[model samples]
Target: MALAGCGTINTVMREDGVAARELKSQKTYCQSIPRVYSGVSYNFCRLNGEPNPDGAFDGHLNFVPFVFVDSLISGILDTALLPYTIYRQSADGSIIIR
Candidate 1:
């Protein structure tokens, strides 16, 4: 529970640098995905439709599911890149759009 709280804090309270930019951009990507067939992406728009602590972290949380689905369509094995993805997210935040 405590660890989960840290995710948001980590996202909002992190240093503004390259990593921060990447995280923000990921969220931007999620928002940009068309609503036609991307649940995670659509949820991204909903989850991040407003500015809030959770919204900032939603990028990280949604990344896996996004990649999970994106991978299927694009034929990219994103799960295999979990370490980078997870680290990017944890350092940035995680997905919770369910």
Candidate 2:
């Protein structure tokens, strides 16, 4: 469970430089992302709309099931972090991906 969504864990939970590094490689069109349910949102952002310019499928189809499962786990984690996230959301606003 801990190993799942390693990228998500790095990008969402950690406030250190690790999150920056993790998000650096991702090609997301989102300008500002919500802190609540962020992991699921991140996953959906990657999976949203048509295939990216790089390829037809982007090779992510195979991972759809796994991604759904990860979303569930991430939702739980997000709920657990709600208090802190809510405060962060009010003070800092949404997380900027652009």
Candidate 2 — which pairs collide?
A: none
**Residue-level error in angstroms, candidate 1, position 42:** 7.4
What are the lDDT figures for the candidates, one per model?
Answer: 0.36, 0.58
Where model 1 places Cα greater than 4 Å from the true spot, the runs are 1-75, 94-98
lDDT of 2 at 19: 38
Q: Kindly report which residue stretches of model 2 are placed more than 4 angstroms away from their true locations once superposed.
A: 1-8, 16-24, 49-62
TM-scores, each model vs. reference: 0.24, 0.66
TM-score of 2: 0.66
User: Which ten-residue region of model 2 has the weakest summed lDDT?
Assistant: 54-63
Expressed as tens digits, the lDDT of each residue in 1-98 for candidate 1 is 22222222233234324223443544443323321222333333433533445533353444444434433532222334445545655564543222
Candidate 1 global lDDT = 0.36
**Model 2 C-alpha lDDT per residue in residues 1-98, reported as the tens digit of each score:** 44435434744667625433334344445555577667666667655534446544333431456667777877787777788777877887766765
